[model samples]
Target chain A: MVVIARSALGKLRGKYDSLSTTEKRIAQLALNSPSTVSEMTIRELASAAGASTASISRFVKRLGYANYREFTMELAHVVVVDAQEGAKLFKELGEGDSLGVIANKVFHSSMASLEATNDALSENDIARAVLKLINAGTVNFFGLGGSSIAALDGYHKFVRTSLNVAYHPDYDIQLMQAAKLTADDCAVVISHSGKNYETIQIVKELKANHVPIIGITSYSGSPLARAATVTLLSLTDEIKYRSEGMYSLISQIAILDSLFMMTVLRSSSRTQPVLMHVRDVIERTREEP
Target chain B: MVVIARSALGKLRGKYDSLSTTEKRIAQLALNSPSTVSEMTIRELASAAGASTASISRFVKRLGYANYREFTMELAHVVVVDAQEGAKLFKELGEGDSLGVIANKVFHSSMASLEATNDALSENDIARAVLKLINAGTVNFFGLGGSSIAALDGYHKFVRTSLNVAYHPDYDIQLMQAAKLTADDCAVVISHSGKNYETIQIVKELKANHVPIIGITSYSGSPLARAATVTLLSLTDEIKYRSEGMYSLISQIAILDSLFMMTVLRSSSRTQPVLMHVRDVIERTREEP
Candidate 1:
């Protein structure tokens, strides 16, 4: 049996016809109430599904899981993802809606975006991206148009860390900056659609230089994400109508914020003194005479 | 009796000692189960409190509410704000936490900040800010350090609208830009601390120019909020530790997003054509043959 890490329920349904009549009963119980089945022990599931313990063990293995425990864990993940998706607020704003209602919709939409984006993040991806950022000669942020705001935000944040960073609002300068970066440097490219012509142009330059690119984008199959050494998605529930990348801005910044926090926490020893020095300089500059 | 638009439960507690015996019963019921009291009609509340409906009406009047419905609405607001505050994820990050745990904390903290900030926004304030933005000859964005990101974002979004928006990353340039604004212009200044030295200087310049200022800050009593013609707060639940204005960034951007949405919605007829024009320009700039 091929062990696909995709949806466990999908796998069960795909191999449903292949199961024995007794195993099909167990599969029926799991499909009917996956959440309930996830909490049931192997022995309990057997009694509930009218199958023997040995049959239940064989049923899980047939579905490509190592054991009942692994099967239950994957089912639990599906439950979580489903619950998260179920809570989506894809509400549309009406012409006569009150400001309070509009504000609620806007805030809830941003929160929903943050929730969906956060759910899709993996620890290994974050760890890999942060490692590259930490070891980079210069962390160059490449973004254009709406995404430049996120890029500038990344620069504003990472500049405070021990790492050196660079960003420019002008697209020409950003392309030039990307060309200057070598393999030792890391490029953090951000785009909502993940397929802007100029953004791809800069990504091309970074790729030619063998620069390790950390792409933050909405689409996984976009040119930027495919070319990136590490890709992080910034998902949003604002698909009903395009508000010119409104909700995506919040999700993108949040992804960067997590990266910033991780970078700081992981390298606190090296970053602490530099952070303090930066704070001291700012305090002195802002102090009253 | 003074009608305090503050917490309904707080008002009930404060006036508990002064209530008549019959009124005290209603107050006790309200304090015990505020959510239940909020849902109950006047007759139900009176019956639950073992009092007459007339006495319940009198009790609400004594509490400075005009009617039973108004009193219930205030109670509902209290319930909502409490629910929002209770949902706050103020969990601290430990050194041994995994990257996934850290990302969850970061994202939840941001969502919490957005929720708290959204709860504090008033419709009247939003209407007033949008009116100012619409009527102004130019809308200039002023923010330093952390807030400049929001200001730049505001500029980025507003530029797509019909409004002549301006923002500069450089502090000196921002100050000069502030100085150039006359009474015809409107300034939207963002500062997380609400009392930054250079931000105050820019605020002072705008004041001297007699420009109407809209302040977005954490504190209502801060210099920026005090000096502005209209003050809109961007609250955060990140008070436990000094994160160098980490969570505030998300809240501020969300606030900008809300304002942008309101502006576009309110002035869609005027902004629609310009929005389409800007989109066309962007598309052409990023298009390839």
Candidate 2:
């Protein structure tokens, strides 16, 4: 898992902006005419963008690629993944397409997010957190916005597993609850961006009071991550559709749900029997008058 | 696409309870010797439950099956599709299973929902309502709770086109907004279940005012479906781990989004250029100083 330095991201963003008129023209043309530019050599790119080959070469270096060849490879990667500048805001989703096509696309995107998540998770950190959870007297969860759904889900899955778990959606009460926590208690906090001000304050208060904090955020360099004993990441490809990416948010919640279910079952022997009993009850009860 | 009558489900539940003594015997044997039970025949099932073959036969009928053979066939279906239920929860989720296995299960469930939705949708009703939308001078969307997110998504997509659209998340504001509508306007109401009182009230008020109504709900026979000029069924599977089945909900929203987008694009030729220009401006601004 390559930990992309914040500085490197900043450098790329900056250099991407600072391309002069000729270089900017070439870059824009590459972004706009991806198929044509992807097939172009340096001279062709210069001709297409109405720029000099030397300027295109300089633009390649500015993006931190070794040479035009590496730069073109990166361009191809971005083009394949994210470069849809002129695609209509929405298209009539085909009724003609088979269910399998729709499902394949949906699951492909979900698996991509899951892969990014695995890349971001640290085994050592997760092990340490699991050890703490195993030793803790109780686990308290805090979340807000769409994230509160994940917290509620965690609470639901963990409650039946013989774990002393507590969660509520109200933010003020959550903060008050966190304030009452002792060192023996564990707090799991989930926020997508990790920069929501109220969430940060609650986390800060927890840190001041010395509670074990488990953070889950997509961005590893977030303040929430710095305050945590362990963290998990939920990744999303930039969702192209509308107001906010509500679809991707749920997938993130599913990941958290998966974690809670896994941890609860692993730490206790009670869940298995309970589940077996439920299944048997459901199955057996299906045979009556 | 078949509507399972509520009374039918209730009767099924009653019949399930009648199998109590036999279920207990069967559960006991199955728990004690799962492999033996798995290998059992009709004679074995009858004996294991400590009931006669006729009783086992009646039991299958009670559980909504035609016969014991059909019951076993359904059980086999559950085994293949839901093998995870046999082994505790998280252990199945975290196992070294192929992606194809997961994809097959998830896709099969989603397809079932899609088919149900299509079956419940009335083509004649939808055509009349779509014609209203195409011809309307104004369209106001009123929804609250989870429905508000979908409502807002519709509004966002439609506003970019030539149509006059309005949506409010607050309940009082939605009522007020509904009050402001006239006979020329159309209202789209959405709910997963048709039972939400607030939505029903707003729909009734809109009715009194003679505003055309377009409804989307899962239950085709419910009040919302009956009240609307058109209803599009949004189907979902019943799964233990899924509370709202948020991923499935996204499919419903995407359907609405596709409709809204297509409507906008259909109206004025200006929309495509506007969308394309918006993307270009966003890119150039982000790329520039």
The DockQ leader among the candidates is: 1
Best-fitting candidate, measured by TM-score?
1
lDDT per residue as tens, model 1, B103-183: 998898888778667766766677788899999999999988878889989998899899999988899999999889999
Name the top lDDT candidate: 1
Report chain A TM-scores, every model.
0.67, 0.59
User: After TM-score superposition, what is the CA distance of residue B215 in candidate 1 from its true location, in Å?
Assistant: 0.3
Clashes of each: 0, 2
List candidate 2 segments past 4 Å from native.
A1-178, A184-186, A238-247, A259-289, B1-190, B195-216, B219-289
Give lDDT tens digits, candidate 2, residues B106-167.
Answer: 33344344445444445455456656777777988766554655676566556655667898
Query: By summed lDDT, which 10 consecutive residues of candidate 1 chain B come out lowest?
Result: B1-10
